[model samples]
Target chain A: MMEERKTKDFPRSDSASGSSDQVVRTIGLSKSFGEVRAVADLDLSIPRGCVYGLIGPNGSGKTSTIRILNGLIRANAGRAWLLGEEVPVHVNICRIGYMPQEMAIYAELTVLENLELFAGMYSLNKESLAQRADALLDMIDLTERSDSLVSTLSGGMKHRVSLACALVHDPELVFLDEPTVGVDPELRMGFWDHFSDLKRAGKTIVLTTHYMDEAVRCDRVGMMRLGRMIAEDTPRGLMESTGETHLEDVFLHKAREGSA
Target chain B: MNLVRAYAIALKTLRSLKHDRRTAGFLVLMPLFMIAIFGYTFGGDIKDVDVVVVDLDAGSANGSVAALIREDLAGRDVLRIGTSEDRDEGMNAVKDGEAWAAIIFAPEFTVRVEEAIEASRTGSSAAPATVEVHIDASNPNIAQAVVAELQTAVQAVLVGYYGANPAITVSEDRIYGEDAEFIDFFAPGVMGLAAMMITFMLSIISFVRERSTGTLDRLLATPATEGEIVGGYALAFGLVALVQSAVILAAAMLLFQVSIAGNALLVLLTIFLLGIGSQGLGFLLSSIAKNEFQAVQFTPLILFPSILLAGVFWPLEAVPDLLRPVSDFIPLTYAVDACRSVMIRGWDAGEIWPQLVVLAGFAAGTLLLSAYSLKKRG
Candidate 1:
């Protein structure tokens, strides 16, 4: 159910047809909360278009990394680049859609109103805002409950609405934080398919989750533990290197080795 | 700046309040309820105090001073006459808090008066009349009130009996508040109190809730800067404060007949400024509170200072001169002073600019501090 497409023919970036660019790049990026190192000095470079899964256990600094990338929190040292511009200085936040793990959509607002608010934050004009909001609602298959208060929706339905809010502005890069946690198998597969469609449209997608089974759907996966990225490879490559049959056991093998 | 964004946020908040009928009703009726409760309960007039009389003059041979005292006390309703045979009984009554004060007429009171008059015929000036008053001084307000009432009553009686030919007299003429009732004196104070309560309590709790719910973090993650978020909320609550002030002012005018001498719009402006200052203070305080309960615990820290030093309950002049400077820092001091001057003294914005400037300065300072506090490392 996690694998929405059997073709393994994910769309390659048009830039690979002949363009010069790395979508996101960070050098010596570090963040610390006083004495505790949340994200140690690290270097990362992600190409323009890929579904990147960051899999980690709780308190592994996965969320902290995403927050720093989102510019919600500052790093202690080094620099980050989003698209071509440096992070924090030239990154236009409206160009990025971030769905937090906390489901920060207003509970008192209707599903449609939540989307409208996010739309406003992006400075989308009213005429286009309604059209975009409707398209998002229909795409998320929440048109039937669009008028309902988010507080009244089921957890899975609320998650769908949260995703809709993140896409209301049609951002270039999307951050989905545990987007499929409470979703059942069928719905989770549907979300992955939507993300696959977004990746096809040349949007960079980054997600964090603890489910090792879902990591196979990503074009690339980074296994992190204890404020460090333990492994960064394709699912098959990680399994082959660990001599494990399942991605879950491969994660366990890497966690034990500490530097895989 | 960014008035459009501020308007959007304000309209969104107002719509939320509309949907939440309970909070909407609270905003409309809470100030009125506070005003009614405080005005009716703590605003009673200090009048018709009960006093005991020990008359040893035997009702006098002629129309004596003792008779005149009873008649004047009865007329002004200043004293409810209670006669006791022994002075000890009346004094005990006062000590035991039975009566507010006691008037004692000595045994030779009429004899001395007649002899003093006879001696005055030999071209000698007579001494002023003396009456012994035994009072319970534990409550200085009541004690001093009784003394002033007795002095007025005695002067009135002497004037009436002596045909207004007194050698000395004291007269007072009230300029403003000639017929000011308790409600009149309290209406402006109630306005300030309402602004303080709504701005401080609701803003703090609501901001703290946003923090706990993670919505604030999410908001900060957006393109909305710290200034935009705080500014948006200030705009919303500022409009709310205006509507609340208008409601309270109309109610005071209609129900209590509270008159306004200055421009009513200026009163609203004062309340709006007060609300801004108080809301900024609330936001600053919410940064210190980790939760709603902790937020509520800090309310008394603001409330006690405002209540005692802002001259809401009494005149600022009544406060000791040494402690008068402290009232200058209490933001509500400006609110109460400006509102009272507008309603009672018929002062306009020109006359009340000093208070307005102080409140404006307070609002600016607190708002900057509140915004900075939000940026601190947690």
Candidate 2:
């Protein structure tokens, strides 16, 4: 089934030219903290301009893998690449946007100021930063609260502001870690729509979520368990191959088979 | 390494402070309040100790020694004199805490003094005429002041009665602080302490919050380098420390009339270096603390040692010989010493270059270590 899906969608060229089609590629990527292996002997090939979801339960190492890819943390062994450049290097950071699972925006700063800070770190020009901030504020539907302090905003509003900050730099590749965990249902739908829009604009997104329903929205999903990927396939392909109608059932079948 | 990115971090810090009114208030007002409390309340000379006297000596043909002692003590404002008819009453006054000391004169006080004088003139050793002083020794400063004042009174009476003794004479010529009061010596120390404490605390808590809240990870994920983040915080906190020092110095000068004998610019420069050092220290400490609560636990670790050993309250000479060397390792010691030498002794860069060098070394070392720690990934 995996071979059939790969041939149907990816169709490898049997040559080095295949790497250009992928934005992120990892080989035997592993990390350990004390006795716990957060990620172990993992390999991934995520195509460019696709919405990829890493689905897992809590403590399943999704965030650790993303952190290793973003160079926030070092892998214990093996190598990962972003934009064809080895990571844990600084050259490709400017080309990526990262939103951590925690509410990472500065609460003491106003919304506009937070956006401005991230923009400045990316070294965006004044005119371009101003336009980018305005457009992101509109997209996040936070244009009115732009002048309000982040500490004064409600939890949902702060989550949206955090998303706006990640997008402010307009990077080609973005990593959003549970971006819709606490978001309201309406805003969660709005966020998925925005993700689709981002993908249509030729940008790659790598997100981590535990919501099975949300996994179906991704172009491809990697189900993780016990620090290893149990399965990777399209939403329809996973459901059809497992003889299950729901993504959660497919994940359960994959997890059981992985343990067996 | 990029100055523009470092400046962006600094600008963001300033913007955050503008919105965090509570911390901003603490940053500016805490130093001012410290200056006021130290300068006004704890900065006075010990004076006007209460003492009681009982005179039992009868008048003699030569002179009354009790009357001479009384006259000498009355001339000096160091003591407030009260009288009692019985020696027991005077001693009771000291024991009851009503008076710091009690002076009791013997019945043959005048005759004994005259006889001693006669024997001294004949080049013979004589029994000394003594004044019995019962003192409360609980407070060492008050006890010493009482003893010194009484000795001065005795010397004055002997000089008047026996003429000036040519055997030995002592003169005082001070190199610094000739007429300076305690507050003048204290203001500079407070400036250094305030700069160190405020800058260190602000940076520690700020960085800890950034780390625990995951903003540090987000920033790290950006193009900003570790050095840029550390440099940015150092620049911002350095400015805040300078402002705090200036406010404290201005308040000290205008309110307490504390003197600044040297170039005011040098004093500020010393404080600025101290601020940078403290900021670097804050960053280094932040790497150890996992949360704001843990960060705050470090306050006493910094406060007690600095206050006791940094010559903030007392000079290094007053600290025990064994503990004195500990002050040399604390960064605040050099800052306080440099500021005092600059503001009180009017010392220039040439005179204080060693202190400035140590402070610069501390700032550079801590900042480099802090930046390296930030770059380390777990």
Q: Best candidate, TM-score-wise?
A: 2
Residue B126 Cα positional deviation in candidate 1, in Å, after optimal superposition: 17
Q: Candidate 2, residues B175-238: lDDT per residue as tens digits? A: 3444466777778888999999999999999999998899999999999998999989988998
Model 2, docking class: medium
Report per-candidate TM-score of chain A alone.
0.88, 0.92
Q: What is the DockQ of each candidate?
A: 0.32, 0.61
lDDT of 1 by residue, A1-260 (tens): 11121222322433322134566666656777888888775556677688888888887787888888877777777566676566662345787888888878889999998888888777899989989977888888888898999999988888898898888888777878888887899999999989988999999898999998998999888887877888889888998999998888988898888753
TM for every model, in the order presented, reads: 0.72, 0.74
- List model 2 lDDT by residue over A156-180, tens digit each: 8999899888988888899999998
Task: Give one digit per residue, the lDDT tens place, for model 1 in B1-378.
Answer: 899999999999999778766556656765675565345434444554677887776535675766776677777654567889788887777644467567777776655555545555556766544567876433344456667776777667656765432322222222344455667667788788888878889889988987887678767767777777887777777778888989989999999998887788998899998888888888988877777866876676677657766778755434444445777878888898788777865778877898899989888888888777666533
Q: Specify the highest-DockQ model's number.
A: 2
Q: Which stretches of candidate 2 lie over 4 Å from their true place?
A: A1-19, B1-169
Error of 2 at B163 (Å): 13
True-vs-predicted CA distance for residue B350, candidate 2, Å: 0.4
